[model samples]
Target: MAEEKFPINIWVNEERYEKLQTAGLADMCEEMLAGLKVIRVYANSAQRDKILQVFPTAKFDSATTKSIELLPREVKDAIFGKVVEKRSIDILEEFLGQY
Candidate 1:
């Protein structure tokens, strides 16, 4: 069976969109919420646990897309950076490794 992948939603502003565009990641942000573009980064359960431990404000919105939301801007930026750098959404392990 395929492994479960939990999502972490990152809202993209104009500046972030430009960066994503430059990185060729703009197309990945196909989802929109409240007029803002969004990219969903997938994480494993272990990574999600680490993230929740690291950022007490973060929560898993199981009712929605089963996404991890409410992360601080800086943390989101770091996750987005990993997305841009790797050109992929499967970045939770790498991002969590730092913490």
Candidate 2:
């Protein structure tokens, strides 16, 4: 069976959106809420496990989209930066590798 994927949402502002567009990743924004753009990066089971291990404060928000929530702003910004640099949403494994 395919593994369940957990989401890590990165909220985008105009500056971040411009960077995403330049990185050719603009189409990755799947949802926009209350004038904010959201890009949901998926994490497979192993990567999700790594994230939980690395960030003890993080938890899955099952009440919503099963997203890995409560991440600090700096961490989210770092993740977003990595996404733009790599021009891909498949960044959880590599990003977690730094921890």
Candidate 3:
């Protein structure tokens, strides 16, 4: 089975492109660019690079960069909240065990 690929259209500037390059997600960024007009789906990272090679001038938006930056924190917070809740339960169990 092939991995699922989501198509997204976004505008990107040089700063955001640089950030993508720095994070080694340039291929992913390129995939977004290729998705703008092409119906082609990228099945792997290699395909993303190929799409970028074909569409080197694809654009990116700052909002996309901002959202990407924020996504990790949002995910982390959600996971951290669950972890803390679990730890609290464990601590309560330990306390009750002592009694």
Give the top-scoring candidate (TM-score): 1
Ranking by TM-score: 1, 2, 3
Evaluate model 3: give its lDDT: 0.33
Candidate 1 lDDT score at position 10: 84
Q: Candidate 3 — number of clashing residue pairs?
A: 5
* Distance from true location, Cα of 19 in model 1, Å: 0.4
How do all models score by TM-score? 0.86, 0.83, 0.24
lDDT pick, better of 2 and 3:
2
The digit string of per-residue lDDT tens for model 2 on 4-68 reads 99888888888888888887888878766666689888998788878877888989887967889
Candidates sorted by lDDT, best first: 1, 2, 3
What are the lDDT scores of the predictions, listed in order?
A: 0.85, 0.84, 0.33
Model 1 agreement with the true structure over 1-99: per-residue lDDT tens digits: 887888788888898899998987788886665577888888888888888889999998888678898999999998888899999887777778888
Error (Å) of candidate 1 at residue 48 is: 1.2
Best candidate (score: lDDT): 1
In candidate 1, how many Å is residue 97 off? Answer: 0.7
Where does candidate 3 stray beyond 4 Å?
Answer: 1-7, 31-99
Clashes of each: 0, 0, 5
